[model samples]
Target: MSIQEARAATEQYLPGLIAELKHQGLMQLEHAEPAQLCQLFRRSNAAGLLIPQQYGGLGASPRDTINVLRAVGSLCPSLAVMMTMHHHTIATIVQLGGIIPAAEDLLRSIANNQLLLASAFAEGKPGSPIFNSSLKASAVDGGFVLRGTKKPCTMSHDMDVIVAGVACTDTGGVDHQGFAVIFAEGANITREPFWKTPILRATDSNALIFNDVFVPDEMVLLAEGANAEEIEASAQEASISGLCWFQLMVGASYLGAASALVELLVCKRGVQDTHLAQLAIELEGAHQALLGTAGTLEQRQEADAGLYSQALCSRFSVQAAIERASNLAVELLGGMSFIESEQVSYLLAASRAIGFHPISRTAAAPTLADFLRNTGSTVDAPEPAHV
Candidate 1:
């Protein structure tokens, strides 16, 4: 389906969201902290799109979720990126629903209140594992005390809750990799300016500092492992679902940005049919690849390394397609459009951000290679090669 069709589907799911976001004006949406766009998203109850109906969510399917993200990305890339973080965090929590205590209550609260959740799993350090947190948690009588920082935490300003990866030490001194849920109301939690990039300034991807923040025992989800490697192993398996959703949605988000540029070219008369066809083939091919992977994920009973690999493959492909499509669109749109308005340049730059997400092509190459070599073998999180 075309990007227009995707927007139509998104309208069906999140009615008037596109119009509301577009009404904010592109400059305002891109240059300022997306408070209004975020508010509009919450008002539309888009936060619950992935949550189950029982949890006060819309329970939208994977395809619908992808379409909505793509449409939103076309309008506001920052909002789409923020939504990816929120929805994937929701997806991960949902996967752990059977184990997390009072998860139902948490899900219901998020859905009903339209609360925004920000993920602080990425350390933003080269060669660092996204699942491994520099944030350390020391076991306490009732809970754990956390200390460290997570930079470039998207939606930092508007998030009601922050889910962060941490290195937790038990009373016995056994260290485990885990996730800690910290409320934004925590007195010890603070934020600093981190994202200086003008391109995605609206995302509010700032540095989140946890200064002796206390997290209740129930708020921490520790993997079933005693040490670093084992913890990573267990966490890796659990991460497949979240990673798959993240890559697919993020890829679609950037694809949507590229599609926006392509739309402009299509609107301009006298554009060559061959040039238009090339853009369509690249974009639509990537879109279908995402759809195919999403269909597979939906049919599966559970997530595995194999599906995660497929998702990554699709995401990387989409990344390439987005770059190519965006460049081609800009060239066809001519120099006047490029010099007169920031829209074309903005979309072109934003679409390129797909390459900056976690598990970069270089980081994932070794693991993917191993998986490709032995299809029966489980994919492992290899030490990322320095790029």
Candidate 2:
């Protein structure tokens, strides 16, 4: 389907979102943190976009989800990036919902109340693995007490729930990696200024300090492993599913940002036909890659290392297209356009932020190489520490 059609479908799920965002204007949306945009999202019941219908949600399909993200990215790239964190968290919770009754209840509450969720997976350290969180947890009487911090936690200010990866030490002294669902209510969570960068500042990605935060047993989901190295098969599968969804949606969002620039070119008629065609081909190719990967995952109705590898490959490809398209669009738009307005420059900077996301090209190279060499290899394996 066309981008227009995709946007129209997005409107069906998030009514009046695009209109309201436009009303807020591009400069305001891009320059400041997205508290108001997030509120608008909550009002539009966007929290239920991925929740199953049975759980009082929209149960939007993967294709529709990608479309909606792309539409949002075109308007405000930060919101789109933050929403990927939210949606991916939802996907993970839903995948594990069968075994966790509390998580299912949480989903219903999220759908009914339009509560926003934030993810704290990456710790913002160089060469650190994505899943290897520094947030520490110690076993306590009814639950566990969390300590440490999650830097660059997207949706930090407005999130009602924060799902964080924790390095937990159990009563038996077994150390493992797991997720902790910390509710905002009565929790000891605090925010600190962390995201100092001007690029994508609207995401509100700051440091969330869990100061002796108490998480009950019901709010924790742990993988079956004697140590971090031996994560259970089921947990690994769920993680693969969540990560695949993350890559697809995140890639589409940046594509939309690049498309915004290309659309401006088309509207102004400033570029030659051949140049326009080149931009279209790159952007459309990236779009189809995302859609095709989403479709494959949907049809399979399951996630594995192979599909996850494909998703990573598609995401990197999309990243390359975004960079190329943004560069070309800015150059073709001319210096006058650059000096006159922030639209071209802002989008260029924002679209390139996709490369900064987890599983960077450098990190995934060896894993991808392994996958390419052996078709039966698992892409869900832990990344090398040096990445």
Candidate 3:
């Protein structure tokens, strides 16, 4: 099917899936049960919107994934995020060219609603300033051993597969160089509940401790070393979709939250709160901007296909979308916005959590800027065009 057709099909199935979550009372629950979001992930996987068909996924277009996620977030932000994390994991694996041969089986299981995955990065302690990973992995015997903790790992405890990011050490100066995307189960993993936010509590963002976990070579996705400039360059090029996909998902969440906020406002349309009215306008602006960016992403020129321009656009677009969602959420809800029951409060928190999600702005900006500077036409005095 065409990308547009795939998108439409996924959008068609989204509302019912969201309604199911709401019916299950998943919408009102606290943020500590990341596992509960499984229903939402299962539904998305059933739709097969995020994964490629060759790998047992529906292989829907990126636009399709964004639309479904937006609808899901409107009802339960936590569920939406869980779905995002799952796709992020699967997409990363796919982009890296079957990091594990079992990747196909895993995708099939995801499609069958038997497996779930989460991004296992972000530890409490600092290690790699870019990824902010504090976890340490030591190599031994036939496989590698991992020791360290990750904080705010979405659905870490409940995930069937935890994609842990670990730094490989070598004799050459602490290496911090080669990175491993280790695929392991949550069976032996210890989960310490750490999510303190009022929103996205269902994400169960907990601390994950790996005590000498053995990841076989097959389970290890050997990406270029983080410290090796050439390896990093290759990874950046290889993980294009992995890097940009989150932008679409983040925008979806913001748009979903904005929609919810507006719906709430519509209930009190004539309530004479000018501030709310203005907030509504701001939300509208954000919505339009998000849609515009989506269009830009979809319409990227073939000539520029290999360039990092799309990723650049996605990086900035995600940050701006999160900012807009937060701004309007605070304005429209006012003092009560902090209340968990408030319509936009959960969404606000989700946006905040995602704002600080993987690939922080500080880390993403310079890489994006370099791409734009290299590709963009020089604005230097317009080359004194012949008048």
lDDT of 2 at 176: 74
Q: Which candidate has the highest lDDT of all?
A: 2
Q: Please list the C-alpha lDDT of all candidates, in the order they appear.
A: 0.84, 0.84, 0.59
lDDT order of candidates, top first:
2, 1, 3
RMSD vs true structure, all candidates = 5.7, 5.8, 5.2
Model 2 segments more than 4 A misplaced: 171-173, 224-231, 376-387
Candidate 1 lowest-lDDT run of ten: 224-233
Q: Write one digit per residue (lDDT tens) for candidate 1, span 47-90.
A: 89999999999998888888888888888888889899999999
- lDDT tens digits by residue: candidate 2, 215-301: 998887676436434445556777889989999988998998998888888888646989988998888888889989999988987
> Candidate 3, residue 362: CA error in Å?
3.0
**How does residue 251 of candidate 3 score in lDDT?**
60
> Which ranges in model 1 have alpha carbons more than 4 Å from their true place?
170-174, 224-236, 376-387
lDDT of residue 203 for candidate 3: 72
- Tens-place lDDT per residue, model 3, 185-302, is 5344677878765666777777887777777666654443554565455444435555556556766665665556555655644445666556555555554544555555457511
C-alpha lDDT of candidate 2 relative to the true structure: 0.84
Ranking of models by TM-score:
2, 1, 3
Tell me the lDDT of model 1 at 152. 80
